[model samples]
Target: MYKLGFIGMGNMASAIQEGFINSGYIKADEICGFDLSEIATEKAKARGVTPLSDGHEVIRNAEIIFMAVKPQVVEKVVAPLKEDLKGKALVSMVLGYDFAKYETMLDPSTRHLTFMPNTPIAVGEGMILLEDQQTLTDDEYDFIKKAFESAGSVEVLPSHLMGVGGALSGCAPAYIYMVIEALADGAVAQGLPRASAYKLASQTVLGSGKMQLASGLHPGILKDNVTSPAGSTIKGVKALEDGGLRAAFINAIEKSMGK
Candidate 1:
């Protein structure tokens, strides 16, 4: 049997497979999955993932199954697999779901938990948000955690915080991508070449994030360090403040969580 299986082979699913395989946590041949799209199935095959005939086949051939289907269609996709999933560990990437919701969906004997991953997971620097699992044994949970940690940082949070955690980490990448684009545009406005501007902007953001994580310093303190007295950095910071950048991001998160 394959070690891991995916029910959906869309962008997120493909990215997760790439992450796991590249990290050497699991071999490509050890993974199996099924997607309704022929193109997705072909892509999986190209990645050395065993593409099964259907979700039921995936369940039968894999030990751990990742459900990355859309939230709206999750019930439709999983409803028929109740018996097949009896002893399996199912990690769900579908949003707007919690343990309580799953209690009504899967077999009681099936071990499952919510898993929130972002696009950056395709690389080895993503954030993985997992909800504490009540049904899974300690060994089972730790193995899952370690497997994912090989790809990115893993945080197991209480179910209550899963939504916001997902928003902060999962949704923030798009925001950062937008910030990178805007920074590049600003540089281009200052006569820099677009390609060079984008490269610089992207690296700056990456370095800044690494600095904060490595130094364990407050972001405000880091900003202060960069913004010397009457300096250009301070001027740029003032412009961002004037443009309500902070409020915009805060409101964006709130809107994302449907608050």
Candidate 2:
């Protein structure tokens, strides 16, 4: 029965709102959104939620506030709401931003939760990380957990690791999509239809990922188990090695974190 308001109607916010509605955790009317664009407002209304004209209006109406605005705008948006934020549970999906940062901007009386959920949450396979400030009560934490569980799996992490966890999860979706697309392209190069190649490549990657988790085996060991002497798997492994696929993935992570 909590009233939730998202200050940004961007993709991540929309994804989460879609999850809440689809999972029956909250009704459309229980959720409200504020976006500066008329198109964005109309888009939110189409989803059966109220579209607010100003960010402060959403704060005034909500018991829970989702700070889904971009990192660049977070400071400006939260600054004016400091006095109006009392008694609300503030959750943020903005990357490169942390709970301490949000705590400094909001009312000292409000409960704070820092979260970073991946794009998969839109499809119910999302990974979520939650970090709370000093003000969280037992009941507040429970409600936060329940609200996120409606979107996907939620895990509590040390506040110090919040940014790192978010960088590795929230921003890694594009990397995964790149790998998936590259794998399908390779299959197509071998004379498979583009559609069929994508189907097989995606499903294979998904099953392999499930196996890695279920079996708790190192990815190298899983690769070894699948590759036999004089087999096609061995040839594929050789190709990946020659192209420096592993090194490229490592470099991608380093580049993402500005290492």
Candidate 3:
């Protein structure tokens, strides 16, 4: 079995691990995590992973070490594991920190991959972004792709674009949720029961998205088809436009990027 070592047993790590197992790419026993917290270690153990006392042991043992800890702890955790990082693969799930920042703490021989995975991979429908420093051959790239294929729709994004593009897909699920909630709120305001409002809003959103994808038409054109001159939709759409809904989303993204 190909072994993967995770240094942190947080939500993102657990999600990816579960994704791998459920997709049959990797077995649970083939993965391991080293955590100082007893709770974390126990959680990983319950998930069928080998538990270790410290991150160093994971570095020494695992062929592929995932630095899945929080961003602030990454530098500290990686420093101790640097000596053992040689010849092994290191994949990082820590956001904001780049390859150069990590290289300062890793052995030069380590093959490092920066993988940006969102929380949605827990359900197996995630958008994952991979950016790497080392030049990989087509076969090497495909091999890496296979691992992520089990988690989500993986893409090779240019390093420069990662910052801007990540703001969209990385935070898409949350954005979508807020929209769904707002839609439900509108329905509930009109006297629909909360459960019924949610049902209607969720299905409409899902169905509309599927329609756009299946029809392969521009969204504006598709929307135009829905809003006849005398239709109720145009008035509702007018209220949305007047409320600056589009501008609100734009500002939300910009605010997220600032953080």
Clash pairs detected, candidate 1:
none
Q: Write the per-residue lDDT of candidate 2 for residues 30-123, one digit (tens) a residue.
A: 9987988787778779989898778788888888888899888889888888778887778788887777776667777888877889888876
If ranked by lDDT, best first, what sequence of candidates would result? 1, 2, 3
Per-residue C-alpha lDDT of model 3 across residues 152-188, encoded as one tens digit per residue: 7887776676665678778777888888899999889
Off by over 4 Å in 3: 135-141, 210-216
Candidate 3 has an lDDT of 0.79
lDDT measured at residue 192 in model 1 versus the true structure, 0 to 100: 100
Question: Which ranges of candidate 1 are over 4 A from the true structure?
Answer: none
* Decoy 1 TM-score against native: 0.97
Cα lDDT, all candidates: 0.91, 0.82, 0.79
Kindly give the stretch of ten consecutive residues in candidate 3 with the minimal lDDT sum. 132-141
Q: What is the overall TM-score of model 3 with all chains considered together?
A: 0.87
Candidate rank order under TM-score: 1, 2, 3
Give the Å error, residue 204, model 2.
2.1
Shift of residue 93 alpha carbon in model 1, Å: 1.1
Best of the candidates, TM-score: 1
Model 2 residue 25 lDDT? 81
